[model samples]
Every structure is written in C-alpha cells, then in structure tokens.
Target chain A: MLTGMTAKEVAKMVKNKEDLFILDVRNQSDYQDWKIEGEKVSSINVPYFDLLDGVEGVLKQLPTDNKLLVVCAKEGSSKFVAEQLVEAGLQDVSYLEGGMKSWSEHLEQVLVYADEQLKVYQYLRMGKGCLSYMVISGEEALVVDPSRFTDVYMEAAKQEGAKITHIVDSHLHADHISGGKTLADQTGAAYYMMKSEGAVFDFMPFEEHDRIRFAHVDLRVLAVKTPGHTPGSVSFFVNDKLLFSGDTIFVGGLGRPDLGGKVQEWAKDLYDTVYEKIAAMADDVIVLPGHYANLDQEVNAAGYVGAELGAIRAGNELMNQQDKQAFVDQVVANAQTETPPNFEEIIAINRGVDVASPERQQELEIGPNRCALHHTH
Target chain B: MTSNKFLDAKGLACPMPIVRTKKAMNEMEANQVLEIHVTDKGFKNDLTAWTKSTGNELVKAEEEGDVLKFWIKKGE
Candidate 1:
C-alpha cells in the first residue's frame, strides 16, 4: 500500500520518472502561476463544495489505480481530498501531506524565473509564497515578506547598508507563520497590511492608497481586496510596477476557492478582481504571486513575489481568457479532493483563537515542516 | 446559595479557560466564592493579573500536586 509521499519523497519521484499522477486542485490562475511538474500531472478545478465531484473525475483519469498523489496550493485541501478518495474506494490514493507548499519549503523544490533586473521566488507554502524585495534604488535595500528565518532578511538589510524601514504582509496569512511581526519588532520597521487584515492582529494597519515613503524608496502599497484565499486577502502594488499578491493569485494556479467556505461568492469575486481590477493594470505591471507551482524538475526553490510581478503578465492564455464562470467551474470541481485533516487547527491559530502562549503555539503546530497545514501567521 | 463554585483552569492555555472562568464568575451572585484550577506555569501571573485588573478578591492561592488552585470571591 503506497501512502502519500512527504515533500522529500515527492522530490525523489520528480528526479526519477515514475508512473504517478500529480493532481493539482487549486483554481486556474493558481495552476498557471506555479504547478508541480509530471508527464502525467493533471489539473482538476475542484472547489470545496464540489470537491467530491472533482475527485471522481480525477480518479477516472488515473491508470490502474496504483497511486495517485493529490496536490493543492496548500496541503490542507489536498490532504482532505486524498482522505475522501480513500473513503470513496480508491485504495491506492495518497496526497502530499503538506501539499506543494511543503514541497517548496521542505524539499526546496520551487520554480524560479527572472529577468536581468528582477527575480521571482515561486511556490513557498499553500500558494502563499513570500515575496522578497532586494532593490538597489539608492542602496541595496530589501522589503516585504521575510521568512521565519529573520537572519536572512537582517543580513540582506545589513549588506545593503539600508535599514528595512517597512515590512508588509500582503494579508494575514493562513499558511506559514508571519515573520513580519517579528521583523518589525526587531528592526523598529513599520509593519503594514490592509485594514481588513489589521482588524484581527494587534498591529499598525495600512489602508488602501497608503504610500510607504523611505529615504530612497517611495512604495505605494495599494490595498486591493482579493479575498478568495482568505477573508482579508489583499494585493499590494508597489510603484504601479510590482504587485505583492499574498494568496489571492499564484503563478500557474489560483488560490483555493473554498477558503472562508464561500466558494461560490469567492469565485465571482476572484473573477472580477483578476480580470477587471488586476488585469486592468498595465501589461508591463508584474504579477507577483504568493506562491508558484514547481512542476519543472529543474528548480529547487520557489519563485519570489517580486520576481513574479516583474515578468508573469496576463499574456499567458490562462490569464487572457479571464472568464469568471470558467474559473468558478474549476473551483467547484476541485474542492472535493481538497479537504485536509488538520485544517481546524490551522484556522484556529490563524484566527488568533486558543493561541495565548508559546506552548500553545507549539502544541498547535506539529512541526516546522508543516508550512501549509498549520497556520503559522 | 449553600454551594461554593470552584473552577479548574490548570495547565490550560490562555483566552479559553480564562474566558470560561470569567463567564462562570459573571453568572454567580455577588459575595459568592469560586475556585479556579490551573497548572500552567504562567497561570499564577495571568490569574493574578486578571484578579487585579478585574478588581476581584483573591481569598487564597496555593500549589498542590503541580496544580495551582485559586479561591476568588465575586467583586462588590
């Protein structure tokens, strides 16, 4: 009996040509942005409500019922879907325990794309890849979405001789712990996110059209509500050039539609936001995603948000055909193979419930490798 | 009422057990006695802070078998 592969196992499988099916359950925009690569990789638009429907079809597509490794932007939904498949008589069904997000963090397997001046880190956690800004406007300065590893951001800031004056979380994340709070507290930098995300956390929140001005950097953090991924998910556009998409959009995939459990409503919202609000921006405006799929067997680290916004435009056929109904249809189809076992723990921690102490945090988080299943932020 | 109300909040995380105790205290009449059970290391400090901040009377607080028990009276 073949169980689900850990991120490490998945990495090995990618190296060796295996007859396994990698099923991606996140929405279309997310799938296009970043996806795990396999000659046999298949994408099913499964929203949470129509999760069973989505899984039934994917099951039909598999050959010989050997082992189907289900995947999603985050691990929670994919794990849920995998368990459901097992219940539905698919004996050899397994999912990436932490999903693709785990693959990015634990295995360090991510797809990266870059231009001469910028680079994007793809596929970090649950389609919520952190974006790092290493700009050399006046000095070698970095901004936004540092990891739990504070030293990385600190070192970058020091090397630039540029103080990190601002740290912004695109939204209150449900996957991966927010290193922003710690970064701000340590560096005396102003931590900012949309007012919606700000309501839940005890921090200084920035609203729409707020501009973060530093000595050499003038970043206009536009708070565009892209709430499919989470209730307070927002997209931040800096200087009308780079967009910091938290979980709202992905490189090859859209965020999980059933997030906040309003798949129908969120699907429509994503449609308007992406086609009208986001697509309306200049074609040159970079589309930085929260995470990307590591379908390419070559890359070992996810692309950064900054790298995404600069290059990944709406020119891709997936982005150009911005049909709201199609996106929703995909979401409705994919939700079945998407439920995970430990989503409640993730949601509780994300909502600031039952997390009053460090021990409580530890208890909720099973491991540091649980980048997608447990809400660290 | 003849019955004394007691609460056990030992070794529990914050915001949950504390919130429950507060709700229980609210339902009790004034001058009623309530006991809380806690085993978390920081419970002593948290409970003490809560008592001070809420103006409740802490009649007794003692450690027994790794559990910290607190006797509190409803504030006037």
Candidate 2:
C-alpha cells in the first residue's frame, strides 16, 4: 500500500527543506496555471494520462534516490499512479491526500495567544494570504474575518470545545468571499459589520467603542473604528493585549486606501488612523492582521502573522510619516493600478447584494491574493 | 446523449468545469440540454451535488475512458 500525506504535512516537510521531488501528475495547463511552490523542492509535471500508455518509459525519468511526492487534481489519479510506481520497485512514495484541491484550500492553524481566560487561533489560508481568527473564551468563541472555508473554523471551534457565538467581517472584503455570513447561518451566531458600509443584508451593525462580552470568561472585545481600507473598517482589540487590525493595518504595511477609487480622501483617513488612533495604542499590544503578502517573510518565529505595534510602526515608514500631505502623496504614488480580480462581484457577494454558486465563488478567488502592498521601502 | 449545447471542459480543474457549465447553461433556454466533458476525477461528485442544489436536471452521466460526460437540462 502506498503511503498517504496531507497537504499540511507536505507543506511542513517543504518548509523544513526536505530533499523531495514532487511528481505532479496534473495536466500541463493546470500545472502551468498553478502548482505547489517552495524554496527548495523541485517539481516535474507528467500528465497521468501519458503514463496510462505505460509507466516503463516514465519510470526511468523519475529519481529513485529521493522520496517522490505524487500529486494530481484530486486524490484518485495520484493514488493510481503511486501504486504503479511502487509496483515498478521504487520506494518512499506518497500521494497527497485530497490532492491539489486540498493544497490550494488548506489552512494552517497557528496558536497566537492562550491563557486560562482566552485562547486565540489564527487560520492562515495557505495559498491565499487571507487570515481568519478564532478567539475562544470559556465555552463561547468569536470568529473574525472568516474565509469561504467555514468548515475549518467550525472544526477549530469544535476542537476547542467552544460554540461560535459571534462572527464579524472587518470590512467589505474585495479580494475574497467573506465566510462570516455562511458561518453565522450555520452556527446561528450573530454576524456583524458596520452599517455605514450600506450592505443590503441583515447584520448587527457595530459602532466605535462597542464592547462584546462573553459570560463565563473575563475577556472583553472592544471594536475600534479604524476607517482607511474602507469607510466602515473596524479593528477589534481583545482584552487590550491583542488587536485584530484587519485590513486597516498589515504587518508589512498599512492597508492601501485606493480600493474604493477615492484615493486622496481615503488616504487622509488612513493617515489619521495610523498617526492618531493606532499610534495612541500601547506599543506592546500585538497587532494581528487580516492579510499577509508573503507568508515566508511575514510569519514570525512563533509561526503566526503578527508583531508588536511598536515593531510594526518602526518597520513601516508609512506608519511614521507625520506630515499629512506627504503621507497622502506617498499613498497616491503607491496606489495599486491593478485591482483584485472580480472585486466588484466579490464586494456584491459580501454585501449580500448578489449570490454565487460554490463553483463560481472558487473561480473568482483562484489566484495569488493582491490585497497587500509589496512594502519595498 | 443528444443535447442542444456541448461544452468541452475536459482537462479543466475544479470550478472551471462547473463555471463553464453554468455560463453555458445561462445562454440556453429552459429544458435545453447541455452536455459537458470533464477529465477531473472529482467532477462527478461535484456535478451530482451541484445539480441537486441548483435545481438543474442531470439527464444522463456516462464515463468513457478517462473522460466523464454529463447531459444537464437547464432549469427555469
């Protein structure tokens, strides 16, 4: 029997610099469009159909010395191919469980904070840099900025022995579908967003200084209005120890205020939020953001996407620009020319103005996330 | 199977096959049959579940070699 490995396990091996060869059995177009990427691992694409004629010729091309990682669109083809490889006398072969579908949709849960009163888990959507959080306090939990993979958050909440009580989107997500509504519907949790966003859906509108309390635990989540990325952007501060900065601020840089097409006006809002509101917060508070541009660089030693507010502010020059006009000019100069793919439709879906089939949703979000700036400075 | 429209989604991955099928179905009138050819192994399960939820009728599904073919009738 051929061994089976999960996407997470394979990712860990790749991260550890394992000398393994990835035998991608997916078609040429699919392989070219998207495949696993790692610093050290090498991949060779050989369509599974090509091997059906016979594996004798393909067997010679594969390296017998290194461990071979077989991959396909889904688990079926990879398993069939791996079986053939084993029969051909090659050892140390394993197929990726659920195949490339799982790889693209995998989420890595990193424990960011924990104590007797509260525990925070960050679900990093691997391929996309979207970050969602699960904060468990006693028997209740709150999910922030959930992705379309609602089951991941549900499973995490189940493992923590907590029921999802509330779900909130930091703002209207343009790049990807927000799982908040679906999660709320599934768990009967209260879903919230800012009323100023003009969403045509029903949600508990959160305003500045609104405190959410869990009955049993001593944790209190305070919503702070941090408009910049969007007009209704808000960041949740948990127990004054950790701040869910959302898209208003990222670890690499502040959220680009150009998405709404009113760059100058929104940039001013971003500048004030950065220089006035965020600056007034304690330097020691950990800032957990909504999105990350590069996981390899943004993920810290603890393997979570965040840093102290002081460190974040010190690293990003945009955060320290005291002159309002200069900050706006810099932001305008760096405004993204290319918008997120299907952003209008995504926004419409997020606002409950439109609906999409699951397949349609996946097609709209199938690519590298363009929500964050490169932060070259 | 006979159909009013044919979509060659073979070699396409998940979502693309379904996405293309949905687009094809949109242009077709109600009761019009749309045929799709898919190579992804998981397309069978996806189409079965998708048709059930979307109110479309899966007229016939057949497998030939590595390809899976389905005839779907558009819903009103």
**Candidate 1's residue-wise lDDT over A96-203, tens digit each?**
776554654542323343444433233233223344443334433434555554666676557646666667766655444556666777888777766554235556
TM-score of chain A of each: 0.55, 0.84
Tell me the docking grade of candidate 1: incorrect
User: What TM value does model 1 have?
Assistant: 0.49
TM-score of each model, paired residue for residue: 0.49, 0.74
Flag regions of model 1 displaced more than 4 Å: A1-142, A198-200, A222-232, A295-318, A321-329, A335-343, A347-377, B1-76
In model 2, residue pairs whose N, Cα or C atoms come closer than 3 Å (at least 3 residues apart or on different chains), thus clashing, are none
Model 1 CA lDDT for position A170: 63
Error of 2 at A269 (Å): 1.8
iRMS values for every prediction: 16.3, 9.9
lDDT of 2 by residue, A83-155 (tens): 8999988888999998876776778888999877888999887666789999998889999999989998898
How many backbone clashes can be found in candidate 2?
0
